[model samples]
Target: MHYRLEHADLSLILALVRGRSLARAAGLLKVDVSTVFRSVRRLEAALGRQLFEKSRAGYLPTSLAQSLAEQAERAEQALEAACVSLEQGGEVISGTVRLTCTASVLHVLLLPALARFMPAYPALTLELSTSNDFANLNRRDADIALRLTDSPPEHLVGRCLGTVSYRVCASPAYLSTAALGDLERLAWIAPDDFLPDHPSVSWRRQRFPGVVPNYRCNSMLSVAELARAGLGIAVLPDFMSGEQQGLQSLADVPPSYDTALWLLTRPDCRALRSVVTLFDELARAIRLGHAGGIPA
Candidate 1:
């Protein structure tokens, strides 16, 4: 007996192959663990072949299953290409473009560009996922990812928009009453313990080991808000230090992280008009706004 595989089956196989565990597969497919377990059992019964073997490590795919997954990946790529071709002929672009970026980037950079882009392309729907963690594009987690990094992943295609500069900033109110002589004496708002590995946080710890934070936050935007409220001084991206925010830079302690602003997306996703439009618009707006974006 012969069995035909549907798109869902193909996706399931690919996710399983990549994820190597039921939970991870479910996460990649955006489904529950039971769903993945049921699908695997169903596929095995329908095809009359074992796809994966349960091991102490995880779900290990058989050689036959690996081959099927490879074919499925190719099919998915072809489908994406076909969709892109069909979309290109149409004058109006309509589809959801998932963008993953840090909240700081959204607040300082993306919002202005999105405000204008949304009006121009009324048919397009934009979904923004704000997180410091990089979204996995290979599993279709997000169509586009905006990041600040020294090196971008080789798998994705994107443009390095420019350097994102960092600076120590505080409200004028906080600075006025504060002692100017000793930097360690000032109240500092630091990145949370969870983000100890964050470049800014690491930099602060190294530069001023004695400076204890009065407050801690994980989100860069929140840290900036605390600084703006005269709570404490914080290291913030240059874009956040806009004159309108009434925050002045502490020129005495200048620190820079050698990272570039990158707009990245999978090669297959780049062909879609929604992704292409937003990608170009962002690159243009960021470059224009920051004017070379202050070299890192």
Candidate 2:
């Protein structure tokens, strides 16, 4: 056939393949779900090949589509490597790159990555805003945001780092004495009334309404510390606990609610080389499992 696939076509295919869902692909491509759907239909018609099979899980790519995606990924990697090469060639990368995320994210995930990142890019200054509230990217409140939500903002373009699963955890010292099957009977370290809408708090309310927490803290970091100190069992993201922190999971908290972690930025802001550079660096660190299996 004489048909030719454009870069856009390859990118669309690759995004769909990697993202595994129209919604996720749309998020990564910074387009509407309808746009991704239409592009898939158009591509299939032109190429005369089935690219994906839709299932309850997500889009499953065919062998042909997978092969094409592999090629697209190589192209993407080459471009990124070239960018890094240029940066290393003494290309001055200056200006502030502001980022916002929750305090827990800073302590458990972003800090280790940033510790290594800051020293390398001396010219690049970073303004780290730690807040539970989502910063308004539309108003340019921040250059980038690492947010945990099922629905990321449509105006921003970015990648879903990964899904974060919650676990009911306590220090081995606490778990040794606590009853495992009767979770409600156990002493609980919970989010404060200030965070009534938090997933863990809501989960507790729904599942064990009569269970009063022994410790309540607005800050997840504090809650974690309280749990680590063997105060009570706390529902925490798996990244926060586990063998590394001397915590053991007593039960698995359902991830039926908000879980997806996204790294988002304004479309126009991506045009800035420094912003893109930081974005790439953070993304790289997360995917490589710098902190935990969050990006895996």
Best by lDDT: 2
Q: Which lDDT tens digits does candidate 2 get at residues 159-251?
A: 777777788899999878777878888899988977777878878888889999988998888899999998889999878889997799877
- Candidate 2's clash total is 0
* Span of ten consecutive residues with least summed lDDT in model 2: 287-296
Instruction: Kindly list the per-residue Cα lDDT of model 1 for residues 1-296, writing each as its tens digit.
Output: 89988889989999999999999999999999999999999999999999999999899999989999989876775565456557665456656789999888888888887887677665666778887666556678899888877677777888888766777888999988898787778899878976777666777888888778999997888898999999878887777785676799885334356467888888898679778888788877776233232211
Query: In model 1, which runs have C-alpha deviations exceeding 4 angstroms?
Result: 1-90, 252-256, 288-296
Model 2's C-alpha root-mean-square deviation from the true structure amounts to 17.7
Which prediction has the highest TM-score against the true structure? 1
Q: For candidate 2, give the lDDT of residue 247.
A: 90
Per-model clash counts, in order, read 0, 0
Model 2 earns a TM-score of 0.65
Clashing pairs in 1: none
